[model samples]
Target: MLKQNLQLKLSQKLSPQQIQLMKLIQLPTQAFEQRLKEEMVENPALEGGKEDEYEADEFSSDDYDEYDEYDNDRIEADDINIDEYLSDDEIPNYKLQANNYSDDDEDKTMPFAANVSFHQNLIEQLNTFILSENERDIAEFLVGSIDDMGYIRRSITDIVDDMAFTQGIYTDEKTVENILHVIHQLEPAGVGARNLQECLLLQLRHKTPTESVDLAIDILENQFDAFTKKHYDKLLQKYNISEDQLRNAIDQIEHLNPKPGGAYDNSNKAVEHVVPDFAIKIRDGELELTLNGRNAPELHVSKDYQEMLQSYKHSRDKSTAQKDAVQFIKQKLDSAKWFIDAIRQRQETLFVTMNAIMHYQKEYFLDGDEAKLKPMILKDIADLVGLDISTVSRVANSKYVDTPYGTKLIKEFFSEAMKNDQGEDVSTIEIKKILQTVINEEDKKKPFPDDKLAELLKNKGYPIARRTIAKYREQLDIPVARMRKKI
Candidate 1:
C-alpha cells in the first residue's frame, strides 16, 4: 500500500552570511586579526590598509555590480550590465573604509624566546657522569618519565616492564633503582624523587648537617604524618623538644622546595599573552569605553579587481570564457563585500555590548573596588543591549577588558545574586571579596573556622550559611582553619 501525508511545521535556519557574522563576533582582537589576514590571503578581491585617495574618489558601485544568483550551467555576458550595479547615491563609508586607527598608534607585537626544555636540560647533565651505554639509556628513559614537578611517578616494576616491552632492554628492578639513585644526585636536589617525602629528604640531605637539619630529617622520616597534619603538641611530646627547637626544625622544612622541577627555567613552554579587546578608563570621573583599535582593521575591496571588471564590461567578446571570467569575478567581489559588512557588524556588536556592561557596572569600574560590583548575569546584559543571551555569553567568555584595576576576563564581572539581611540583592563576588579579607586579617595562630566566618558575615549583614561560607572559601582557594594553623 502507498500513501501520502501532509504535515506542516515551521523552522528557522541561519544563512551563510549570518553564520559568518556570528563567528566574527565571537573572536577576540588577536584571533580576529589572524582571521583577517587569512581572508586577505584567500580572497584576492579583498585588500587591507587605507585605500588610496584617488581610488577612493574614483570608486563607483557601477564598476562592481552584485548579482543576486548564479546559474551552474553558464552566466551569459548579456545578463551582466554596468548600470545594474550602479547606485543613484554614493557608497557608504563603512562599506569602503575601516581606518579607525591613527598613524601615531604604536604597532606592538609579542616576542618569543627560544630555550631548551626541562627534560633536555636533564639529559645534557647526564654527559657529565661516566655512564655505560645501557645505564645511559635507562637514565634517559627515567629522565623522560619525570613530570614537570620533577617526580618519577611510576614504580620500578612498571619501568622495568616498559623497558622490556618498548625499549627491548630488559633490566631488573634493583638495577633501575640504582640508576635512579644516580639521577637523584643531579642538580635541583630533588629532580628524581618518587614522592613528596623523598623529595624533601633528598634536599635536606644535600644541605650542611646541623642540629635543626638533622632534626628536620628525623621528623620527615619518622613523624611525616604528624608533621604534615600540624600535630604540634604530639610532635613536642614525641621528640621531647622545646617550642624554640621545634620551630627551628619546622623553619628548615618549610624553606625546602617541594616541587624542584618548577625551580628549573622551562622557557620552552609557550606563553599565552592576552590582548584586551576593550579598555575602560575614567576620564573626568566618568567611564569612557573604547574598543581596541586593532579590532577595527581598515578593509576594502581591491581597486584593481574593480577596474578589471570595468575593462571586461567594455569588451566586445561575449564568448563562454568571458562569461566564466565574469562569473568568477562576481563571486570574489560578493565575498569581499560580505566580509567587510560582517567586520563592520562585529565591531558594532562588540562596542555596543561592552558599552552596556560598562554602564551596568559603572560603580566598580569608577573605583577599583570589588565590593561595589552589583549582581549581574548574561541575560541582564543581553537584555540591556537587546541581544541574545548566547551572543552576550560568547563575548564575555573569551574577551578581556583593560580596567584601572588590571586587565580582567569579562566573565569575572558576572556572578549570581544573593540576598543580604536587608533583602537587597548583592553580587557573590562582593561576598567572596569580603570573605577573603576576613580570612587575611584573622589570627593565623587560631584561624577562624567556617562557622565563625559565617557568624561574622551575618553580624556584618551578609547572613550567609556555614556551608555556603565553606563553598566560598574553597572557591577562593583558602585552606581550612586546621590547615591555616601556625606553630
Candidate 2:
C-alpha cells in the first residue's frame, strides 16, 4: 500500500538580476568592455559616454505621474472596451529612437596578418620536383601526415592504408619510402623524419661534413639510446675519444634545430599580451591604486528613451496599443538601468576584494618578494568583504592587478600555510622558493634526489616528507635527479 506523506524542504534560487550580476562579476576588463558595447547595441535605451548630470534630473522616479490614472481602476469588469479609451489616429510612431549614434561616423579598419600555412609552403616546395602523378600524390599524403612538430608520426603500413582508403591510390611501402626521402631533403632539413633520431641525422646530413659533423652523425645513429641517456662513459669507451671531442660533437647536435616547424607558428596564433585591470604606484613610501580607465567608462540611460517614457505617461487617454508600447518601453528602460547599476556594483566589488588582498599581501607587493606573501584563501577575503566565498573566487580567478614591481595575477598571492620550527604559520610558497634555491645550487653532475632534498628541508626547519618534496619540485617544474643530470 502507498501512503501520502508531508515533507519539508529548503531551497535557494537566483533572480534574473542576481544571475546577470554573477556573470558580470567574472568578466575581465576587455571582455567587460565588449559586453557593454553589446548591451548598448541591443538596447537603444542604453548609452555610453561622458554625458552631463542632466540624466539624473530627467529620469527621477517622482517625474513619472502617467501611471497614477490607472491606479484608481478597481472594478473587475466582464469586458474592458479598447475603443472606449483612445483612437488609432492619436497613436504616435512606436519605433525605438536611436539618437545615441553620432553624426560623425568614420569607418575604422582593423589589422590582420597575411600568411600561408606550413603545409601549404611544403606543397609549394614539392611542385619544384619533377615526379610522376602517383609519386606526387604519395608525397602530398605524407605532407598531410606530418605533425606540427615537423615529424611524420605514421608508420609506412599506416601511410599505405591511408592512401588506399582516402586518396583511392594504391602504393607500396617502397614507393612511399622513396617519396619520403625527397620530403626529408626539403628546405627545413628535418621536416619529414619519422622520429627524433632520424630527424637529427637528416639535419646533420645537410651540414658541410667536418670531423665534428661526422662524429655527431655516428653517435646519433649508433648508440642512440646511450647518447639520449647521457651515458658519457659508455660513449667515451666505445669511441676511445677525448672529452673535448665528445663536447664538440654534442655542441653541433645541440645547434641543429629540433623543431623545424616552429618558424610557422606565427601563421596560426599571435602571442596574447596581458591587459592588467588595476595599477599600483608607490608614491612617497605609500601605495596608490587605480582601476583601468577602460573599466570605468561613463554609462547612462539614453536621453531619447527617457523622453519617450515621460511622453507616453503624461498623455490623458490610454489604449490597448499604447499600453503594450508602454510595457515594452518600461522593460527596456528597466534593463538598461539595471545593467548600469550592475556595472557599478561589479566595479565596487572588484575594488574592495583587491584592496583587501593588496593589504593582506602588502609586504610582497612592496618588495616584490614571494617569501613575504602570507597564507591566504578565498574564504579570508570573503569574510573580510562580507560576501560569499564563491563571489570572492569569481573575482580572484579572472582578475589581474599591476604593482610597482610588475603585472601579476591576483591568484598568485594565495597559498596554503604550514607550521615551521617555531610553530608559526608560514606560506607554502616560501617553502617552494627554498626548494627551488636548493635545486638550482645543487651539483649538476650529481643532482640531489627527493630524500636528500627532504633532509635538507628538515635541516632548514621545514620538516617536510620526501613525497611532499617531490610534489613541490613538480609544482616548480623541477625534474628528477636522473632527468636533471648533466655531464
Candidate 3:
C-alpha cells in the first residue's frame, strides 16, 4: 500500500497581508474604533490629534481655508463653519453640505445603557449577608453554578466534588447546602434552584400564604410532569382544587422572575453600531457608491519617509556600516510602499465587490423588502467582480450597508435557495418564515406535533419530512408540541 506516487495539483493560498486586509474590512464600527485606538498606540507614524490639543487647536485657528483643505480627521471636519461671510439678509447661493454622521449616532442618541448582567445582580444580593472569606468563597462558588436562566442545573454534591478536585478547596455537603439556601432566597427568588420543583418552590415560599398557592406548590412537588404537561383533570382529583384557583396560583408563579441575576445594572458596555463598510445610494435612477469614512484616514506614503529614502540612497561616500544602515532604510521603504499599494488595491477591490452586490440586489435596496432579496451567494458576486469566491466571501463577511429605509448587515441579503417540487427556487429564509407563521397560528392547547406540521407543510406544497420539520423547529428554538402545550 506504501508505493511512491507522483501527483501534480494547482493550488492557491492567501498571503498574510491579504488575510489581514480581509479581517480589517470585516470589522464593524465599535470594534474598528478600538482597533484604530490600538494602532495609534502601536504605530507612531499613524496618529490623530492628541487629547489636550483637540479643544485649543480647534478654536485657535483663523485660517479657515487651510483647515478645510488639510483637515484629516473626518469627525473634526464636521465642526468647521463654511458660512463665515453669510448674513441673515444675504441670499447665500452655495449651501453648506452636511457631513454624513457615523453609525455611532444611535449610541450617542441612547439615554441609558443599563440592562441587567448575570453576575452583578447576584453580587449585590450576596453583599447584604456577611460571611467569612471561606464561606463567601463557597457562596460565590454556588452563585457561579447558576446559569443565565438562573437555574443551578448542577447538583450541590457535584459542586463539592468540583471544588475538592479542580479548585483544591475541600468543601462538604453542609457548607454548599447552607450557601444554596442563601442564594435561593436572593432577589428573583427562584435562583440557585437545582431543578424546576426547587426553582418554583423557592419562589412560592416568598409569596403571601393562601390555600391555593400552598396547594399549587404541593402539586408542583408531587405531580410536576402532569402540571407541566397541563394534565388539569388528574391534578383536580389529586388536589381537589377548582380550575379558577389553580389558574390564580399559576399566574402568581408566572409573575415571579425566573432569573434574578438578569436584573442588575449593565452600564458602560459599548454596543456595536453597524457602520457600513460600503454605501450604495440611488440618485435619479442611478446607483452611487462610497466607502465608509471609518475605513481609513487620508493615507499615503509619508513625505518624511520618502525624503529619508532619497537621502539614504544619494549618500555614496560611506563605510560598510553606513551601507548596511542604508540597506535597512531601503527595506523599510519597500515595506512602506508595498503597504501603501496594498491599501489602494484593497479600496479598489472593495468598491468592485460592493458594486456587484448593489447591482445584484438593486431591487431589494431600492424598495427595502426582504421578499425582494434575490437568490445570491459568494459565487454570483465573485463572477461579477472578477475575483475568486473566497475573496468575495472575505469582503461580505461582517460587513454592513446603510439604506434610505434602514441600516442592515450586508450578509443578510445573501441566502441559499431551495428548489421546490415545481422546480422554482425558494429561499430557505422563506421556509423559516412559513414555519414561524404556522407555529404562531397553531392552537396552544393542542399544539401540532412535528409529524403533523410536516404533513401540513406537504399539503401546502413544501413536501418536507418530519425530521426536517423537527430540525427547522429546533433551529427556530421552538420546543416540541408537548412542551408548548398550555391550559
The candidate maximizing lDDT is: 1
Cα RMSD, each candidate: 3.1, 7.2, 11.1
TM-scores of the models, in the given order?
0.91, 0.84, 0.73
List runs of model 2 lying over 4 Å from the truth: 1-6, 56-112, 266-268
Off by over 4 Å in 3: 1-16, 29-124, 130-137, 144-154, 158-172, 208-216, 240-244, 253-259, 262-270, 280-289, 313-316, 420-422, 458-461
Instruction: Please estimate how well model 3 matches the true structure, expressed as its whole-model Cα lDDT.
Output: 0.66
Per-residue lDDT of 9 in model 1: 94
Q: Candidate 3, residues 348-457: lDDT per residue as tens digits?
A: 67678888898888887777766667788888898887898877877777777777777777777788876667877766666777888898999987899999998887
Poorest stretch of ten by lDDT in candidate 1:
52-61
lDDT tens digits, residues 159-207, model 2? 9998899889898999999999999988688998898899899999999
TM-score of model 1 relative to the true fold?
0.91
How well is each residue in 1-487 modelled by candidate 1, as lDDT tens digits? 9999999999997767788899998998888999999999999988877654423222234566444443355556567664443333334456444445675878876687777788898999999999999999999999999999999999999999999999999899999999999899988898999999999999999999999999999999999999999999999999999989999999999999998998885435668889999989999999988888888776766777767677787878667777787777767777877888787788888899999989999989998888899999999999988999989988887999999999999999999999999999999999999999999999988999999999999999999999999999999999999999887
List per-prediction Cα lDDT, in the order shown.
0.85, 0.78, 0.66
Model 3, residue pairs in steric clash: none
Error of 2 at 473 (Å): 1.5
- Scored by Cα lDDT, where does model 2 land? 0.78
Alpha-carbon deviation at 124 in model 3, angstroms: 5.0
**Ordered list by lDDT, greatest first:** 1, 2, 3
